[model samples]
Target: MCKAVFFKKLKYRRDVLGDVIVNKHKCLYCGTCVAVCPMDAIELIDKWVEINEDCNDCSVCAKICPVGALGGVK
Candidate 1:
């Protein structure tokens, strides 16, 4: 018997940015975070906003969140 290990391929490289989080309880359902991303990495999905891998860790979204819903560790 032979054992093989394989790694999945990624289409895009992920940045080593601090964990970006959206505080759902504090979120206002506003589109401010989506509009502030220079990389076009944020989107308002129905009710909540989602951040995609396109994010460059620029912290723009975090800074723009009026309620401080979005943030990065560093």
Candidate 2:
């Protein structure tokens, strides 16, 4: 699906780490975050990514996102 359609279906959420956030519009749904999360906190479900409470805010996924989709609230 296109980015616009993906954005419409997905919504942001508050996480354990107030810092880490994902811009679904920029996300490619490539599972890069899911693979790099050391705590296994990131998941790619269908078209959206979910960061669970297991996340430690290591920023590993944000650093690895090819599209620069993962980031912080700031």
Candidate 3:
């Protein structure tokens, strides 16, 4: 029972920390942001890297993007 409780808490933490968003219109299709994201939450689709629900909003992708294509929620 104790093990089950610990797993449940861990799952909750993971879910809460995962929040990321990307603007498709601003995306440059350079793939630089995708490559820099540590969480692997960004993916290229139709020349834009879409941010998934798993994104942690670390801003790494945005910082690395040369063209300022990626940005997190303000």
TM agreement with the true structure for every prediction:
0.71, 0.73, 0.61
Q: What's the lDDT of the predicted structure labeled candidate 2?
A: 0.81
Q: What does the lDDT read for residue 37 in candidate 2?
A: 88
Worst 10 residues of 1 by lDDT: 6-15
Best by lDDT: 2
Find the candidate with the highest TM-score and give its number.
2
User: Mind giving the per-residue lDDT tens digits that candidate 1 earns over 6-58?
Assistant: 21122212222364677889999889878778889888898887777677778
Q: Which whole-number lDDT from 0 to 100 does residue 64 have in model 2?
A: 93
All candidates in order of TM-score, best leading? 2, 1, 3
TM-score between model 1 and native: 0.71
**If both were scored by lDDT, which would come out higher, candidate 1 or candidate 3?**
1
Q: Which ten-residue region of model 2 has the weakest summed lDDT?
A: 8-17
Residue range 1-74, candidate 3, lDDT tens digits? 69999987865565455544456666668888778878888888876566765777778887787767665444
What is the C-alpha local distance difference test score of candidate 1?
A: 0.72
lDDT of 2 by residue, 1-74 (tens): 99987754453334422657889999999998899889998888889988876877889999999999998833
- Residue 40 lDDT (model 1): 90
What is the Cα-based lDDT of residue 17 in candidate 2? Answer: 27
List pairs with backbone clashes in candidate 3: none
lDDT of each: 0.72, 0.81, 0.69
